[model samples]
Target: MRVNNFFICISGCLLLVGCAGTTKRPVAPVADASSVQRPVQQPSSTVTQPADKDKNIQIRAYEPSVPKAVAPVHSSAVTSLVAQAQLLESAGDLTAAVATIERALRIEPRNAHLWNQLAHLRFSQGRISPAADLAMKSMALAGGDIALKRDNWRLIARARRGAGDVAGARVADRKARMLH
Candidate 1:
């Protein structure tokens, strides 16, 4: 009976995992040999012909990409800068790391991620008030970003604890727990 219960529990966990996916999934286009249109290339003197010269070839057309200007301060760019800041902080250069993050914020003023990073940095530097303030700013700008809100609330909890505000820390901790 114990073994059967264990198996049932494992099966139930697997079932839940399988069901925890995105609401929608994209369907891929099924390629058909006869329906594919191969671009014809001009035969040049340097071109070599294979033994199966009559074999069909397929070349997908180049797809136009979105312009960089469409997204101000590209996500990768901000991520790279944040990574640099973390490296600087790890090297005990808190000032430089904060400067790097501040610059990133100037570029992406509305980015809650940058604010959250700044809050974390301040927390590490023992600036509890500023850390809490920056964390709150991040939370305000997070919009519908649940992950950012969770991080910000956790940071706020820590900041309050560091400043000896147990009551505030408990409240922030509760909010963070709700997100988790």
Candidate 2:
């Protein structure tokens, strides 16, 4: 009889622990689906156009648009300017050539070729001091081109000759000859 009572008590304790481990179901509030807003649909064929492409628009005519003030001068422009200046100088229009070179210089002031060309122009026009100054500037900026160095020496010689410095002219001439 005692064994039967013990078994009964053990069974009752196991059942109670098992029931305590379970969680109860929660009650949720109901929601109305009809109160939600649906997203609007966009057309599939919508196309975007640039604002500047309108035909029949009258743009107020002003002075023809100049290039951007700070745009870098391209190498092609520098080459063309050099060729044009050479042609003008050959045709005895030293003044125009000088002006053209000056314009190019404004675009690429650090260009050695432009500086050398300006020196040549000044030397041709009998502006000795300015020519020497330009030649020095060119030499300082020149890369490792032998022809450019030779031309620089020639400009220096011309400037020295114009200034009546025979020794200086001789020295420059010798340097130019060495480059050849």
lDDT, candidates in the order shown: 0.82, 0.81
Residue clash pairs of candidate 2: none
The sequence of per-residue lDDT tens digits that candidate 2 reaches over residues 1-180 is: 999999999999999999998988888977789877898544434445455766443333234332232222347877788789989999999999999899889889888878887998898898889999999898888766667778899889878987899999999999988864
TM-score result, candidate 1: 0.57
lDDT of 2 at 93: 98
Indicate the residue-level lDDT of 97 in model 2: 97
State the lDDT of candidate 1 residue by residue for 80-160, as single tens digits: 888899899999999899999998888789888788889999998889999999999988987767767888898999989
Best candidate, lDDT-wise? 1
Task: For model 1, state the Cα shift of residue 132 in Å.
Answer: 0.3
- For this target, which candidate reaches the highest TM-score against the unseen true structure? 1
TM-score of each: 0.57, 0.54
Look at candidate 1 and tell me the lDDT of residue 37. 100
Against the true structure, candidate 2 reaches a TM-score of 0.54
Q: Name the runs in model 1 displaced over 4 angstroms.
A: 1-77
